[model samples]
Target: MKDLNKQFSLILLYALLFQGLYAVEIEFNADKTLLDSKKEILELEGNVSLKYQALIFEADKIFFDKKNDMFSGNELKFSSLDNFFYGAANIVEFSKTKLTLKEVEFSTCPCEEKIWWIESDEVSFNNEEKIVSSINSKIVVQGNTLAYLRKANFPISSERKSGILLPEIAINERSGLDIKVPVYINLRENLDLTIEPRIMTQRGYGLTNELRYLGKNHNGFFNSSFLQDDKESFQVLETDNLRWSFNFLHQQRLNKSTFFETNTSSTSDPFYLTDLGGFMSGLSRTLYLPQQASLSYFKKDFSMRLDLNSFKLTNPLAVNQFQRLPGLKLNYFFNKNNFKLVLNSDIAYFNKGGSFRNNEKESLSRVLFNPKASYLYNQKNYFLESSISLLYQFKNHQGNKNTELSPLFELNNSLKFFKLSKTTKIILEPYINVAFSDQKKIINKLKIDSGLRFNPFKHKQQFGSLFLSNQKDIMIGTKLTHTDKANNHFKFEIAKLSTLGQKILFIEEKRIDLPEPFSLKLKYKTNNGIIFKSHLSLDSKNNFNLTSNSISLNFNKYKILIGHYFARNIEIYNLNNNSLEQKKINSFEFSASVHLAKNWSGGFKFINDLEQKKNVNSVLSIDYENKGMVVGLAYMKSLELDWVSILENDTFKDYHKDRFRLFFELKGLGSIGKPKESYLKRRNL
Candidate 1:
C-alpha cells in the first residue's frame, strides 16, 4: 500500500512539470525539496539539478513555478556540450523554446583564470532560433576591460550575420595610435560587405570599404580606401592632402573550356606602397601596380589565351610600361609513334603612354608563327632527342614594317653511368646539347615574348641575354647524384656554353663584349636531417672573378645562409678609347634562424656592403607562442633608394630610420601590432 502511494506521487510530479505541451522527459533531483500542491510550486535547496533535453541546470537554491515552467534561483549554472553560462540571478525563465537568465557572468573558456569573459545584466537564449542576446555587456580580457556594448546579439550558427566585430588597435612609428572599427553587412547568402573606419593620431582618419560576392559561376571582391591626411603628416610628406587606393579581383567560368580572370590595383601617391603597404599586403615592395585581364580556353590538343595588361608606375625608378591592347596566343600539340609536333602563334599590339621619360610615345604590332617537330629515342642508360623549329615574325614599329624568319635545330644526348654497391649507389649523367639559330631581322627589336624554339635543351645561361642572339652553340653539362642506404642524397651539376662565333650582348641595340662564365650548383641532404646547398660562378677569362655565389645550411630547427654577387661594370665609348672599370662586388648577405627554447625562436639577417664597408640592412626578431597567445618583438634598419632622377638625374641611398615593433595576440581575438617580414620568414609562415 505504501509503494502504490509513492508511485502516485511521482505521477503527480510529472504532470505538474510540463505545461501546455506533451510531457517530454524531465529529471529532477534535490537534497531538500518542498511541494506546495495548492499553488503548483516546488522549492529546492542544497545542490539542485534539473535536466531537460541536452541542457542541464545546477544551482544551490532554486524555486520552480510548475504551472509556467519557470525557475528562479541564486548561484545558477547552465551548460551543454558547446555552451555554458554561470551567474547569480534572481530569475531564469525556461520553456520549450527559450531560456532566459538575468544578470549573468558568462565565459567560453574553461580554464581556472578565465583569460577572457563577458558580463551582462541580462542574457537570453532562444533555443528554437539558436541565438543569444545580451543587454549591457562588458568584455574583459585578463581582468582588463576591453569593450562595452549596450546590446549585442550573436547567432550560434556558423553563417555570418549582422553583428559587431571586435575592434582592432595597433601602434607603430609610421601610423601612431591606430584604431579601427568594422561593421559587417550580409546583403545576401552569397554576398557580404564590410565598412571599416580608422583613426590614426599621427596620420588622419580613413575609411575602407570591402565588397565580396560569390555565385555559382563567378566570384570577386573589391576594396577601396580613402584617407584624409593630417596636417602634420602632410607637412612631412610635402605632397598629397588626400590619399586613396583601390583593389579589384574576379574570376568567372563561362563553360567547361573557357574562363576569365581580372586583377586591378591602384593608389594615388607614389609613397603609398612604401608607407602603408605593410598593413595592406605581403607584396609591400611592389613598384608598379598592374591591371590585367585574361580569357583562356583549353581542350585536349589545343589551347588559347587573350590577355590585356596595363600598369601604373608608382615609383620614380620604374619605367613606362607597354599596354597590350589585346594579346592573343594559340598553341596546338600532336604526338604519334615517337614523333611530337607543336604549332604556336602569337599576335599582339603594344601601346605606350603616361608620363614617360623624354616625352616619347611609340606603338608596335607584331605577329609570330612557330612550328616545331621532335623525335625521341629512349633506352635504359642513354636517351637521344632531336628537334627542329621554324619561326616567322612580322613587326610594324611606328609604321616601319619588317619581317624576320629564323630556323633552329637542336640535338641532345643524355648518357648515365652508374656504380652500385651493397650500401651506396652513384650515378653520373653527362648531357650534350648542340643547336643553331639564324635569327636575322627581328633581333634588334624589343619584343613581347620570346617565341617558341628548339626544345629538349633549354638550360639557363649564367649571363643571360636581354635580346635573343643568333648563334651556333654547344653546351656540355654533367650531373652526379649519390644516394646511400640510409636514404641520404647528394647532387652536383656543372655546365658551360661554347659559341661558334663571337657572342654579342645588346643593351637596346648597343653591342657589348661577353666573356664566358662557368656555373656550378650542388645540394646535399644527410640522413640525420642536415641540408646543404650552394651555387657558384666564375669568369675565368676575366681574372677568375667570382661572378655569383650562394650557400645555405640547415640542421634541425636552425638555418644559415650566405650570398654574394659581383658586377663587372664594363665601359663603352662612342668610337673612342676602351677603358677598364673597376670590378665592384655587391653586398654580402648573412641570415640565420635558431630555436632558442621550447617555445621561443629568434632570427637575424644582415647585409654588409663590400664597397662602403658598412651594414646595409639588418634585422633581428624574437617570438614566443604559447597557450593561445603569441608575442613578438622585432627591430629593423635598412637602406632604401630614393630616386630624384625625374627632376635631377641622380639617385641617393638613405637608411631608413630605425624602428621596432611589439606584437601581442590572443587566439580568436585581435592582435596589437604588425609582425614584420623577418618574423614571418623565420617561421616560414
Candidate 2:
C-alpha cells in the first residue's frame, strides 16, 4: 500500500509540473496524494502547500484539475510572497485571472496580531484589475464588529478609485452640529472631482465642489461652495438668504522660459468668511480677498512680467484699497568683470471702486523708469560697492499730470575677520551704507505705493532707501554681526535719514509727520534654540517712538514664544475731521506648545490688546495620538471688531465669539472630525 501511494504521488507531481509548463510555474508539497490520469485530476490530503508566481496557498486538503486549469481547496489559507495581503477561507477556487473565496476573512494587518480585519460571506480578487470585491462584509476591530456592508470594492494598487470618502462631523456654538460627506470621482488619470454636501443643525444646507486637473505643463483647481439659506445671517445684518464663495487657482508653463499663474477668491457677501470660515480666516487679519493674475518671461539677462491685481474688502465700512488693473514690469541686467548695469521699468493703471472721505472715485496711471550702474571690488577680508541710479516717474490722475526726476548715489563697504580652530571658529563682520538722493517736492503728489518705511534698518540695500518714500533723503546705516561655531549669532544695526529738500511726507494721499529718523535693530540667537529680536525707532529725544520685540525658544519636545508691539503717539490725518489725530498702539502675544506625556500634547495661544485691556484672541488645545488613531480637542475665543454696536450711552461695544472643536482619525479608514491644527495653521500660528 505504501509503495502504491508513493507511486501515485510521483505521478501527480509529474502531472502538476507538466501543467505548470503551459500556465504559471507551480510548486506543491503534500503528505498524501491521488492522481487520476484519465480525468486529469490530482487530489492531496494532510498538510498541502502550493506556490505559483507571488501567490501561495495552504490547506489541509486540495484538488487540482489540469483540464480546467483551476485549483479547489477546503480550509484554505493564502498570501502573497511579500505578505502584502493574507486571508483564510472555508472554500476557495484559484485561477490565473481570478481568485474566489467563500466565508472569508482578510486584512492588511499582521497575521499574528490581527489588529483589524474584515469578514465576508464571499470575496473575489481580480489579478488583472488588481481589485478586491466582497459581499456581506463586516469590519472588525480589536475582535469587535465596527461596521457592516452589503457590498464593497477597493483597489489593491496605488491608483485612485471613485468612492465615498469618510464623513466629517463638527460641533460649534455658531453652527451647532455640522456634518459633511464627500464623494470623490476619478474621471480620468489627470482629472478628479470631489463633491461634499454639508448640513448644520442651526444653519442651512450647503454644498461644496472641487475640480482639479493636471496636464504636462499645467495644473489647477476650482473650489466653490453654496448655502441655500443661513439661519444666523441676520446676526451680521445680512439680508441675502443665499451665501456662496469661490476660489480658483491655476499655474501653467507656457514654454521653457515663460509661465502664467492666477489666484482669485470671491464671496457673495463680506461676512461670509466670518460666519462660515474660509481660507486664511484665523491666521491673518484678512481684510481683503485677492484676485490676481500674472504672466512672466525670463531669459539669461532680461525678464518681463504683466500682472492684473484687485482686492475685495471684507468689511464694507473700511476704506477702499487701490487696484492695479494692468501692470507691466521689465528688467535688463548686464554684468562684465566687476561692473554691472541694470534697468527696471514699470507701468500700471490704478483705480478705486469707491470714493475716499467725500471725494469722487479716483483713477490714475503711473510710469516709472530706474537705471543703475554699480562697481564691486571684493577681497578675502574686505568688500566695497559703489552705485549710481536715476529714478523718473510720470503720473496722470484725473487728467492732472505730474512728473519727477531724481538722482541717487550710494556707497557700501564691509570688512570681515575670522578665526579658525580645530573645535571652534569665530567670525565678525562690520558693514556700512551711505545713500544720497536729490530731494524733490513730493507735496500735493498722489501717493501710489510709496511711503515711509517704519523699519528702515531691516532694509540694508541702497535700492531700499531710494524706494522708501517719494521724497528724496540721505540715509546712513551701519551694522555689525558676529557668529561662532557654537551656533551663536548676534547682530546690531542702526540707520538715520535726513530729508534733503522736502518738509512733509505724504502717505496714501494724506499728509503725515515724519517718522522717527533714527532706527535701531537687534537680534541674537543662542545654541540652545533661543532667539531674541527687537526693532526700535527713536525720536530726537532718544526715546523709543516705535518698538517691536519678540523672544522664542524651541526644543524637540516643546516651544515657547512671546512678543510685544508699541507705537507711541502716531500722527495721521483724519479725513472725516480734516485734522491730524494722534493714536497709540500696545499689544502682546504669547504662544506655547508642549508634549504632556507619551502620545499626548497640549498647546496654548493668546493675543491681548494692552491698550484696551482686553483679550483679542485665545486658543487652547489638547491632543492624543496612538499607533493608528488620533484624537484632539480645542477651545477658542476671539473678539470681533466688525460686529460692534453703539450702546444707548453712545459707547461702542464689541462682540466675542467662543467655539470648541473635536478631531478624531482612524488610520487606514477615515476621520470623524475636523483637525484643530488645520484651523491654527490657516491663521499661520
Candidate 3:
C-alpha cells in the first residue's frame, strides 16, 4: 500500500506541472488527499490551501472535479495579493475568471480593530470587469448597523465613475432649514459635470450647475445658479423676484512662451450673495466685483501683455470706477555685469458709466512711458547703487490733450558687519536711500487706475506715501537690521519726506501741509516659534498725532492681532452728491485663534467703531476632530446699513443681524454640512 501511494503522488505532481505550462495553474497542499480516477474527482482534508493568479484560498476541506475544471471549499478565507480586500465566507466557489461566496463579511480597512465593514448574504466578483456586486448588504460601523441595501455595485479599482454624491444639510437664520443634493456625471476622462438642487424651508427652490474640462494645455470651469421667486428678495430688499449668479474661469498655454487667462463673475442683485452664499459668505463683504482677462507673452529679455478690466457695482452707496476697455503694455530689459536698464510703455482707454461734465459720460485715454537705468558697486563690507528714471504721460479727454514729463534720481547704500564663533554668528546691516524728483506739477483731475494702499506694513513708507502722482519731492529713509544664527531677527525703519515746490500736499481730495510726517516700524522673531511686529505713523505738524498703529504676535498654538486707525481730517467720496467731503475716522480691530487641546480649537474676531461706539462685526467658532470625523459650530454678527432710511435722513443707520451654523464631516465618505475651514482660511489665521 505504501509503494502504491508513493507512485500516485509522483504522477499527480507531474500532471499538475504539465497543466501549469499552458493554462491556469492550480496548486494545493493538505495533510491528506484522496483521488478516484474512475469518477475524475479529487478531495483534500485537514488544512487545505490553494493559490492561482493573484487569489489565495484557505479552507478546512476542499474538492475538485478535474473533468469540469472547478473548485469548491467550505469555511473558507480568501484575500487578494495586494491586500486591497479580504473576507470570510461559509461557502466559496472560484474559477479562473470569477469568484462567488455565500454569507460573507468583508472590508477594505487595513487596521486589525475593524472600525467598519460590510455584511452580505451573497457576494460575487468578475475578474475581467474588476467589479464586485453584493445582494442584501448591511453597512456596519462600530458594531452597529448604519444602513441596508438590497443590491449594490463597487469598483475594485480607482477609476472615474458616475454616481450621486453626498448631500449637504444646514440650519441658519437667513435660510432656515437648507439642503442640497448634488449629482455628478463623469462624461469622459477629461470632463465632468455636477448639478445640485437646493431647497430651503423659508426660501424657494434653486438649481446650480458646474461644468469642468481639462486638456493637454488648457483647463477651465463654468458655474451658474438660478432661483425663481426668492422670498427674501421681495421681503428684505424689495427687488426683483428672480435671482441668479454665474462665474467663469479659464486658463490656457497658447505656446511655449505665451499664455491666456480670463475670469468673470456677476450676480442678478446685491443681496444674492448675502442670502445664497456658502461658507465663505462672511468674507465677500465688498460692494464691487471684478472682471478681468489677459494675454501675455514672455521671452528672455522682453515681454508683452494685453489686458481688459471692469467691475460691477453691487450697492447703491458705492461709486462707479473707471474701466480699462483694452490696455496694451510692452517692457524691455537689458542686464550686463553690474549695469541694468529697463523700458516700460502702456496705453489704455478708460471709461466710466456715469454722467460728469456737460451730461456726458466720463472717459479718458492715456499713454504712459517710463525708462530706468541703474549701476551697482559692491565690496566685502559695503554696497552702493545709483539709478535714474524718467516718466512721461499723455492724456486726451473730449479731444483736449496734454502731456507731462518728470525725471528722478536716487542713491542707495548699505553696510554689513558680522561676527562668527564656533556655534553662533551675528550680523548687523544699516541702509539709506536718498531720492529727488524734478519740480513739476501735473494737474490731472481724474485718477484713472491708481489709488492709495491703506495698509502701512505692506510696503516701505516712502513707496507707500503717494501713488501715480507727479510732484516735486525729496525723500530720505534709513533702515537697520540684526540677525543671528540662533533664529533671532530684529529690524527698525524710519523715513522723512520734504515737498520742494508745493506748500500743501494734496492726496486725493484732501490738502495737508504736514511736512514732517514719518513712520516707525519694528519686527522681532525668536527661536521658539514666536514673532512680533508693530507699525506706527505720526505727523509732527499735528502734535505727533497717531495716524495708524498696528501690532501682531504669533506663537505655536495661539495668534493675536490688534489695530487702531485714526484720520484727523480726510476727504471721502460722496456717491449721492457726486463730490468729496471731509470726514474723521476712528476704528479698532481685534482677532485671536488658539488650539484648546489636542483635538479642539477655537477662534474669535471683532471690529469696533470707536467714534460711533458700535461694533462693526464679530465672529466666534469652535471645532473638534478625531478618528476621521469633524464637528464644528460658529456664530456671527454684522452691522448692516439701512439704505431706505439713509435717503430720508441724509445719514446712514446701522442694523445688526445674527447667524449660526453647524458643520459635520466623515472622512472617505461625505459631509453633512459646510466645512469651517472655508471661512477660517479667509480670515488668514
Clashes of each: 0, 2, 0
Error of 1 at 63 (Å): 6.7
Best-first order by lDDT: 2, 1, 3
Candidate 1 has an lDDT of: 0.68
lDDT of 2: 0.71
Q: Roughly what TM-score does model 2 have, to 2 decimal places?
A: 0.81
Q: After superposition, how far is residue 83 of candidate 3 from its true place, in Å?
A: 5.8
Better of 1 and 3 by TM-score: 1
Task: Estimate candidate 3's RMSD in Å.
Answer: 6.6
Least accurate 10 contiguous residues by lDDT in model 1: 642-651
Candidate 3 lDDT over 172-205, as tens digits, reads: 6666777788888889889999888888777777
TM-score of each: 0.79, 0.81, 0.78
- lDDT score for residue 431 of model 1: 98
Candidate 1 lDDT over 398-430, as tens digits, reads 889977677888999999999999899999999
Who wins the TM-score comparison? 2
lDDT tens per residue, model 2, 1-685: 1112432333345555565544545677787777677786778777888775456789998877777766777668888666666778776666657777788887755336666778999898887666679999998876889899899886544467778887877666777777888898999999999998989888878888899999999999988888876685454676778778888889999999999999887777766665667521211234456688999999999999999887666654545445788899999999999999999999999887422222337888999899999999999889999999988888898998977777778788877777777655555566666667665444455545421222322443333223333444556676676677776888888887665554355544565556536878899999999999998887763233878898998998988888887777666564445567776667787888888899899888777888789887777899887665668998878784421111101222112377777777655455776665653422321
- Whichever of 2 and 3 has more lDDT, that candidate is 2
